[model samples]
Target: SMFVTNSSFCTESKECLEYLLVCKTDEYEVRHYSPTRWVSTDAEAYFMGVGAAMAFRRLFQYINGANEGGFQMEMTAPVLVKIPEETRMWEPAVYSLGFPLPAAYQEKPPAPTSNKLYFSEMPEMDVYVRSYGGWMLSVTSRLHAHLLTEELGRVGASYNHSYHYGVGYDSPLKLLNRHNEVWYVSEGEGSFTSQRLV
Candidate 1:
């Protein structure tokens, strides 16, 4: 049996939670992130094929300690990707991918060999999430993101347009019961727009 940690740090809707999922797929998630109080407002939709691979490779090297001491770091859960609106067949729009690390290592993460890869501590947030199964493809990401946006509108739930996030758990080889999520941040108390969702 795999080691399981806490469940449901952020509240979820019935539909969000009911979507079929497999837990314990990723590393230990660190809930407390500092400095970066909230997700930024930017629309970066990574291109599908090599874009994703190159992005991951960059981070992989960073975590593998391509830095000064060569001190390899651990991996974390829910490799996230932010999708874009416009896309073509097999050639998806520009997007971004991310990996979370345990809080213990956040204080002094190894220096990144590549400037593209950097350490960030994400703050707690309220987001509208849509859960789904299967591999995270460009088409799938767009479809679910649309579905989630529509649901929020239908429910009259107010949200900001920070930056939408694609949360993916599990590796490629693990076919059955793959878990994925797209997060739309909720509107903050002020005049903050969320580029993530809208």
Candidate 2:
């Protein structure tokens, strides 16, 4: 079974304990974070994606490296999940899954808006993914995508779908400059490496 929660960061401490109880009994676990500490302002949206991707990469590497008994790690490209605005909770217990961006904003422009989170039926396919860090402007992101496509072709591994999900780690209120912003590629597949971004 999959579970979802929506809560504010300030109230997270209280809600987390409740989530832990549910997770203990649930067959599949997934958590969502919203009203996030990182989303302080609208301008930071673009860079936030990059930061999230990098964090995820590091987390994945650390978990996989330990490779404890019967533990297996699978990589995924980020997809935006449309969830209700009332969800909260910060960690993935077992079989954690989420889309990088809010679903309502997926095709919308970079503007102020909000939408309800909607869950959909699961797809019947699998994809490989790699994460990237640093800024992903038009020139850089596209270049990376192309390189990935080429490499995947050579290895007979290709993506059925590709998306660029950004996560903002810092609060946007403190920054008035672009340099203060960071972006991460939450999910995608190719020969791309986290080192390339560093």
Candidate 3:
């Protein structure tokens, strides 16, 4: 069997949530989460969360890299940008915000009690995606929402009337961890764009 993975990040502070989603072909497994959604806003909350999510996703791939299977998989990492309010383009979808729980704050990983933290079914659709690197300050989710709105307008794609969710990926370890990258899912897809991480 084969597997695929992807990561994304938000360049603005308001788009703090980062996410990582992975799929396995053989077992048909899919998993995702926001690692830094528990820490309160401070100086480095946004970057920390993004870093954690990225790290976790890389760790996940590293652990599964040696598997031998007949199936094949691909991965994608997308960073959602904030859309401006002045843009009268795509319609806004469901929006949310949260902080990550630091390891020092929790003695152990929280037990899974609900599907909300794992995976939620999304309506099938197509979407445009962009990614970013480095740290962004004075950023907000509104910025990301606005960015998407403008992008849609540029391409003549109007936003659908529905709730869009943000996914943030992170690790339980500290932000110093390397290979930490955050990814967010802004919209569904009628098609997919896959790329490998170097």
Candidate 4:
């Protein structure tokens, strides 16, 4: 049972996605996550918040019994929003938001009723993470992502620049102690120089 229900940041979820802590620096943490399955949806918008909101609703419905089996599922923590690195002001970006399928549904989850929704299988990989407080709005998410990239550059960390993830562990109803993160995928195997957080 890799998935744990109790994590410091995942206060309200019944199940939280699991990851192995690889290293930590003053500004960020490095985590290794195993391959996991998720129910995902994509939305196109000029801002991350707008896209994520739409995508979230779609995904929420799926877990609430909008699937083929009409089977309901519990919510999971650390919902992931894949954000592309490059975007022009005039153009809208496509945001892919995902909720990790519960262990029971990971292997054979109900199929999504919407065409925009699908199942995504993430590969085992490492990521550079920066935690933040408050709402995961477009501005805040981008700000933290920029900050994380700066720290990564300063440390000479090798990571993927093409895209990153905006991770959230709380629901909108929870106002206090809201935890959010921005993640930059590691470049490849052996790309990190691991050292325990002191």
Candidate 5:
């Protein structure tokens, strides 16, 4: 399966989530992802970093034998943090962090022991993607998302602006060539099929 073939940026993991690139230009790319399952947790805080940190720990535990069957699994590439587009200074935003389930466990992932952890079933969909380097901090993620949205608007592409994904492909321990991405869900323009690689 394509999931077993890691892209250049996904050096930290043996397996990575796969997507079919539909189109690419100077500013952004369009990719189609198949339905997949993941282990996920949510955290709410004034900043994305705070929320992601809280949520990451729980998801980490689940992968580190914190499941009902004590199934310890290898980490996957490009962990996803779903960030809401709308938030006020006084109100906290919810960040949902998820780790893609390995192909072996996709059909029957071990149940999480913690109540805060749950399974996420992502449906087949198309997304507008923008790549970046450096750490996926809240500021960088938001900046890139803003830039991508501007380009999408210029191209007259319709997308779901309510939320976006902050994707990280490298671990914090790695200091160079870190790869990240911001994704906006495409609306009605994603029904076409393509097989281009990332």
Candidate 6:
């Protein structure tokens, strides 16, 4: 229903539905990649806490209208991040937080005042998704991602590791029933199927 920005974690927002499940977990759903406009910058590992919040705020204001494209856009799930690699941990790593504009606005969305922002469309594709709970601390996010990777490997699924996504659906203010996820792009060409994880 509304989006609230807090740098310690992903941006917060409310939705009429309990945050779209996207697809059933372990279900191997094929979803058309949605379109989102995002901003990217390098942040030292130690500063991810504050840096991320600042970046989100800048982008958030673009839609909220610090310039011209002023509209209270609905926030989307799994604040997609191009999950960084550990070997480069000591050095500054790039983080991207996308605002997946609704399809109607996506084609002609407002321009961001900041050059740090960019827009792109996610092509339709199949993906492996895993759900988790709790705050998205670096360690916690990494663990869920690792588990998702393991599950993909166990199922003999092909995945692209260059990028991994972390999705969050609950506001930090909400204390219980929080939903977060780790997503991997699937390499399979067949039509998407929903498989029960159990």
In angstroms, give how far residue 15 of model 2 lies from its true place: 13
lDDT by residue for model 4 over 1-198, one digit each (tens)?
Answer: 658979888879889988999999889999998877778888999998899999999999999999999998989988999899898999999988888899999889888888888887777789999999999988888899999999999989899888889999999999899999999989867332222111
Clashing pairs in 5: none
| 1-198: candidate 3 lDDT, tens digit per residue | 011232222222222323233542221122343322121111112342353344344323322341223211222222222212232325322222323322232233232232222211222333333322223222433344346545555655544423322333332232432232222233333322222111
RMSD of each: 8.7, 18.7, 14.7, 5.8, 4.9, 8.0
Q: What's model 6's overall lDDT?
A: 0.56
Please give the range of 10 consecutive residues that has the lowest summed lDDT in model 4.
189-198
Where model 5 places Cα greater than 4 Å from the true spot, the runs are 189-198
Worst 10 residues of 2 by lDDT: 36-45
Clashes, model 3? 57
lDDT of 1 by residue, 102-147 (tens): 4444455555566665554444445566778888876787678888
TM-score for each predicted model, relative to the true structure: 0.68, 0.27, 0.31, 0.94, 0.93, 0.72
Error of 4 at 139 (Å): 0.9
User: For model 5, how does the per-residue alpha-carbon lDDT over 39-143 read when each residue is reduced to its tens digit?
Assistant: 888898999999998998998888899988899898987799998899899999888888888888988888888988878777788999999999899999999
lDDT of 4: 0.87
* Model 3 residue 8 lDDT score: 29
Candidate 4 TM-score versus the reference? 0.94
Clash count for each candidate, listed in order shown: 13, 25, 57, 0, 0, 5
**Residue 97 in candidate 2 has what lDDT?**
18
